[model samples]
Target: MGNEANARQLDHHPMHGVLKMSEFINALQVGEHHQQQTIQAYTEYRFAYRICASQLRPVALLQITYVLEAISSATRPTIILQNRPDVASLFTIDPQTGVVRTVESNLEPGSTHELLVIASDQGLPQPLESTAFLSVTVEKSNELRPQFDIVWLTDNGTPQIYENLTIGYVLARISVRDAKYDSELSMSGCESICMKQTDSSNVYLLIVCGVFDRELKNSYNLLFLLSSDDKVILEHPVHLEILDVNDNPPRFEHSLIRVTFNRSADQFDVPRIVATDADHEGNARIRYSILDTNVFSIEPDTGILRLQKEFDCSAGEVRFRVVAEDGGKPPLMSIVDVIADVIESNAWPPVFTKPLYEVSVKEDAEPGTCLLKYLVSAGLHWINLYPFDPYLDN
Candidate 1:
């Protein structure tokens, strides 16, 4: 009994390496011309499998022998995978061959899976078995596509400024999540905006890198790229919307305007000057006026010039300045020259300033040689004088 006390528990065997086994015992007697003693024999097992490559992509399969170590039993053993019925649903095992395989392709990246593997032998009365724990991990694939956030803003955000945004404006901040690789990102096919990353993070900043102009271009589209060895690993598309700013002043089509005036009418079209503004909304609204309104005025909405007072027939030419301004925060303005051309009418006869005049000419007083002439004309009439031998008036 002393020597038998050191014996191990009895083990059973199951045919085909089934995971359940029956118990059995073998006993040897120790004697010195004395009674017989029973010695018990036990079975032991060793599994040599430690999975080295279980990181697999989606829809991948792994062999069972690669992870299931061999089982040993004194009476020929059988091996099987043992797990809860529900847990068993995750995989299938060949009870005869001791092979295991996955049942689904829904593995997640960077996640681990575990299974219970058991081995048994065919023995009488009951069965003896040994168990092992196995683990596997799924990895991400290199063929996965990149993704980005979506935006649908027809109108620009608050402070929708299309021109001249401050140099350090914070346009956007984007955060990324990827477990396959720690790749750096770059921007391509962009003219106005740029991107930069902070130290030790996947977050980046979309910044205003260059100047903006609403007239030339108000928006941009950028391609965000991730790569290694100059080869593209992933790409995402982003769009930007620019709002119009009130920076450019209104301008007239012509810098100089000419107006013809008649004493009868005090109205004139300074060619109805045409002006344009580049800013958006109210900033692009333009107003017009004659700088000096004493003699001339212009319609604020329409650039029509008008003479405020009546002019006489002898009115002379005059020079006036016309101004155009836009309604911006700081307001912008321009000016042009408006010339008033006066055309006199022939409605009255000429009047002499002095009625009487004395002639201070050299009077020879000779017959037919005396001369006294005045530059005077009859009303709508003309005559040619005749001279005789002694002169008509001698």
Candidate 2:
């Protein structure tokens, strides 16, 4: 028979003639009989054939076909959503009308938003069917609003300070205001910026955020400690103090100048020394002095020195010490040194002299009197003798 013909004939047969004679007869006789003997016999045979045929088919084969069909019809698409500063909500759907929803607000900028969707058995017509994903994209909002404002004043008006001036120094007073809301702002970390000032001038603005103080109730005051680079040095808590006008002049911390002078130092040369005070300008003009005697006098207008007596370089070393005082009541004083070296100058010529010496001779003296004489010379006293020792030793 042709293949197509054989397949069609097998479909009508119970087991393609593979059923055992005893079993086939048992199956045929087990079914109900009809009032008409011919019809009842035919019905029983048809039932028995169907029962045998069903046993021949593998149950796993039917399940595999169903699964294959399900996979072929499954639709899976990954969902990606754009990050948003103000994302209202998200929704997901499956083929069987399954739904998932999520909501988010006040999302941070430059951040990603992610959501996962799991299909529940109730959402699917057939629980065993494999499901596909659905991807949806939501655009982000581009609107931005200002959140806060800040204002501050440095304790010394200037942001720069010397290393010595930085110790125990209060850099500045910072005040932050939340224009959006009325509340007290909580400081994140230590609020002080404390470091050496780099340039002659530096300015730092305190940073304040709405997140710090949700309610716009209280204004925040912080001490921003700053280094020379405007970087936060250290933060300290400072009680708000409305400063009063100046009442003091700048002053140096110490007095009793002990300066070393080399013989080479010129007479009446001025040296620069500085003093500091918390007071501002006009109130800080300092005047210096040489309290001892006319030996040294400071230029009243300029701090330059004027020597009354010429310094003696031959006197080994000389000291030109002076005291500085600011123009304040019971004036503040500081002592500073003007070191000078008594270096000898080669510009002066050396002096030479003849040396005479007498030596006793034996009784049998020679006819000519022994005349003994030597030359003595002196160079600049400052010239080191060791360097000329080789020539002198010869």
Candidate 3:
């Protein structure tokens, strides 16, 4: 009605039974003047809208699309009844101009910000319109959870040195609750626990388990401790034990004995021969006996060697054998030669005899002639003797 010649087609919706062709044409020429005026008034009032995320971690701004829709109404021309900005378009806004612009940038987590909207049309030339400033906050989805289990084993209740015990005889049953979901569990320093031997009486086991978060990959360490009571008397890093075996045989330190006796000595003073065995007391039980009867007699249980008859040191040396045997499956026997030297206390003295003789031919020669004289020396004494003929005396 104001300028019918410049009127455009009422190609858009009408409002309040009034033909909006003239208003539309006017708005187009003046660069959306009606909408721009409305935006300016709204900016003076400064409307605020807030957008928040479930988590605080970093995320792509375009990934979250907050759709904004326009509503249709009457009595205001085909105007913007309601306006909203989408989260997907947040990064496309220019911070300096407070208007929607193209931005190929990443948004960091926990970054609080606001966005401004502007008109986007080929023919319209108007100042940017900030429909509403949106405050956005980013957050992560969820927290990390840790999980794991324990296992253990041992062979014998009591162990000794050189004894082999089977460890891992009992296996440890371990399980992690949330391991498969949010965390991971690993075991280390456990190989020793599985195959370790107790080198000392006091032996302990230390097993370590580690838990890591799947998201952060952070590790947490834990230990399971154990102790031994029966086999182990003290606490040590290794296991110890003892084994019984028949590796040593009984033996006497001396195999033979030689003794001296006096002929006049009383039988009550008979000499005793003693022998020892290296084996344990019960295993070392030994019996002694005289191998020959003529020389001496032995008290089997007491191991006493007594002379049957008197011994003289001056006469000669007596030799006798004694035997010692052990009580075993295959009895081991040992023989000792007992030599008794006997000597008389008083010795007899040596005597000498001289022979008397006469030679017949020597008397016819000369009264002064002498037969060959001979001298004899016996032991500590010496004697001289002469021979004469009996036929010369007639």
- For this target, which candidate reaches the highest TM-score against the unseen true structure? 1
Task: Please list the residue runs of candidate 1 whose C-alpha ends up more than 4 Å from where it truly belongs after superposition.
Answer: 1-161, 182-184, 227-234, 253-256, 262-270, 344-394
Once fitted onto the true fold, the runs of candidate 2 whose alpha carbons sit more than 4 angstroms away are 1-141, 144-146, 151-185, 189-287, 299-306, 310-321, 326-332, 335-394
TM-score of model 1 relative to the true fold?
0.44
Per-residue lDDT for 1-394 in model 3, tens only? 2311111111011111211211111121232231333312222111111122212211211101111123111111211112234445334432221222223234455555444333322222332222323343433334332222233332333222111223333334343333222222233322322323234322323322222122232111122222123221111111111232222344446666887665445557557766655443344567777875476788876677666775544557778887877654455667888777764342323333547644455334855456666666644445665656574343
Model 1, global lDDT: 0.51
Off by over 4 Å in 3: 1-256, 266-268, 310-315, 343-394
Ranking by TM-score: 1, 3, 2
Error of model 3, residue 185, in angstroms: 21
Which candidate would rank higher by TM-score, 2 or 3?
3
Better of 1 and 3 by lDDT: 1
Clashes of each: 20, 35, 34
Better of 2 and 3 by lDDT: 3
What's the best-to-worst order under lDDT?
1, 3, 2
List, residue by residue over 232-267, the lDDT tens digit for candidate 1.
555544334567677889987788877776543433
Model 2 agreement with the true structure over 1-394: per-residue lDDT tens digits: 1110000011112121221111110011112221111111110011111222222221000000011112221322222223233432422222221222233323333333333222222112222222222222222333231122223345455322222222344444333321122222233322333323232223223322212211221122333222224332222232222222234444444553333433334555444445654443333557666654545567754566555677666655445656656665555555665544434454345443534345565766554543343343444343222222232234
